[model samples]
Target: NAGVTQTPKFRILKIGQSMTLQCTQDMNHNYMYWYRQDPGMGLKLIYYSVGAGITDKGEVPNGYNVSRSTTEDFPLRLELAAPSQTSVYFCASSPLAGVYNEQFFGPGTRLTVL
Candidate 1:
């Protein structure tokens, strides 16, 4: 399976700019998630969706939003981005609930805000 894929492998944003990190999967997974990982820190959940048309906020959803309109796409929108939002964002998915299955992660999209 293609698993999950994220675009714009690297990005730099100024203090109040906006951007969208795209994520897509070909595994037909029922669960997908967006997470941010800071240097030396564990991944922090930003948002997640159990299936198409269903989405929820996660541990660190601030400054971010998501929509699951189709089974293959779930993108993260960063509005009025701040330096604090700078981090490596990863998109992941699993065929089953994360509580019982291992998550497959994208290569990652690195964002830097100034």
Candidate 2:
């Protein structure tokens, strides 16, 4: 699988703006996650879903939301964009049955808030 096939390469948002970061992966996995990393900082988990119709919050869930009604799409909604939310976001997926639990990552979306 090519993992994440495509996404907007860049996005610019102003304070209070809202947008959805679309993430789609091959339909072979049962787990998906959303994470964001600020400059020189480690990635922070925003949300994750183990399977369809089951979602859970992660370390950083404020100002963000996720839904998994299907196995292929896991979109992250960023509401009321803020400067503190400026970061590169990643989408990852792992199969239900794996030996090492390796994850496949998307190319990442660069979001800037002003």
Candidate 3:
């Protein structure tokens, strides 16, 4: 993605509920990713897709689902939300996978599970 991404900026969920956090980019990036950051911790990759219909698990893929059905959309599904899942989620996209690849991130989705 060349420009900023778009995502739901905040969410509050109850235990056991499910919700889909959607991300979209119009710049037609081939590499899109999902990550989460807990309090005082660095970002942990959750999932990523190189292109439409191709996806792979990242470092922390538990309790989450993702699919790249189209080039412009990648939605992260949260099932049975738990307090541990509460964190700042980010969606990012890049044109290529390389050392100097530049990524554009959404503002962030702050999820609070109660």
Candidate 4:
């Protein structure tokens, strides 16, 4: 089974444009998350879903949105792309929280906005 997958490995956007980043997993994980990493910074969570139909915004969720329609899919949407939003986006999933399970991460989508 594919642990996690993300589309459009690389993308370039103009200021104010929007795009949806896709993420999916075949491990049937119950917890999913979206995070972004700037050039020289740590990963900052954008949004997350505990289970299908349940979602919550994370630390830095200002310009982003997410939805979990099924156990295998959780997609991230950017409303108005900005230069500050340009970063490497990652999708991760774990079997459960509060346990000792490792989260599987996607390759990441690198976005550059000008």
Candidate 5:
């Protein structure tokens, strides 16, 4: 099964523009997350969903938003993007709450905001 997939492998945006990064999984997981990795840095969680119709903000959710309308899809929305939002965004998924579950990450969408 396709663990996770993200669209627009790379993108360049100007200040104040908007964009949506699409993420999907076919693993039937109940936990999905959106994380951003700055150049030479670790990942910072932007948003997450425990299940369909249940989404929540994460460590760094200031300039972003997300929705989990279905079990397989979790899309991240960036409104009025800024240069600070330029980073490699990764979409990850895991099975239902269990300490043993390992997160599966997408190829990542590299966005550069100028």
Candidate 6:
């Protein structure tokens, strides 16, 4: 299984531009999440989905949107990009949310905005 994969390892977007960060997992995990980490900061959850058609906002969902239409895919969209949005984005999945489940993270996408 391809665990998790994200497109465009690196990107540079201008202010006000919009882009979609693609994420897909082949493990058939029911729980997926999107997170962003800024320099010298811990990762902050942006959005999460327990399953298809069920998504909830997380700690920092202000500048982003997410949707889960299948067990293997969860994509995040960023609108009106800003410099503050420049960070490393990660997509992760877990079989469950409790202690017994381990989250598998993607390689991560690094974005810079000007």
Instruction: Report per-prediction Cα RMSD to one decimal.
Output: 1.1, 1.5, 1.6, 0.9, 0.8, 0.9
Q: What is the C-alpha lDDT of each candidate?
A: 0.95, 0.89, 0.91, 0.94, 0.94, 0.94
- Higher-ranked by lDDT: 2 or 3: 3
Q: What would the TM-scores of all predictions be?
A: 0.96, 0.92, 0.93, 0.96, 0.97, 0.96
Per-residue lDDT of 7-57 in model 1, one digit per residue for the tens? Answer: 989999999999999999999998999999999999999999999999999
* Residue-wise C-alpha lDDT for candidate 4, range 1-114, written one tens digit per residue: 878999989999999999999999999999999999998899999999999999998999999999998999999998899999989999999997976867899999999989
- Candidate 1 structure lDDT: 0.95
User: Which of 3 and 6 is the better model by TM-score?
Assistant: 6
Clashes of each: 0, 0, 0, 0, 0, 0
Report the Cα lDDT for residue 12, model 3: 96
* Candidate 2 C-alpha lDDT tens digits along 1-114: 667743776899999999999999985789999989888999899999999899999999999989998999899999899998989999998886457777788999999999
- Which residue runs does candidate 3 get wrong by more than 4 Å? none
lDDT per residue as tens, model 6, 56-93? 99999998988888899999999899999999999999
Best by TM-score: 5
What's model 6's overall lDDT? 0.94
Which runs of model 5 end up more than 4 angstroms from their true locations?
none
The all-Cα superposition gives candidate 5 an RMSD in Å to the true structure of 0.8
Model 2 lDDT, residue 47, Cα: 98
lDDT per residue (tens digit) for residues 11-113 in model 3: 8999999999989988889999999999999999999999999999999999999999999999999989999999999999999898878888888899999
**TM-score: the better of candidates 1 and 2:** 1
What TM-score does candidate 5 reach?
A: 0.97
Model 2 global lDDT (CA atoms, 0 to 1): 0.89
Clash pairs for candidate 6: none
Better by TM-score, candidate 5 or 3: 5
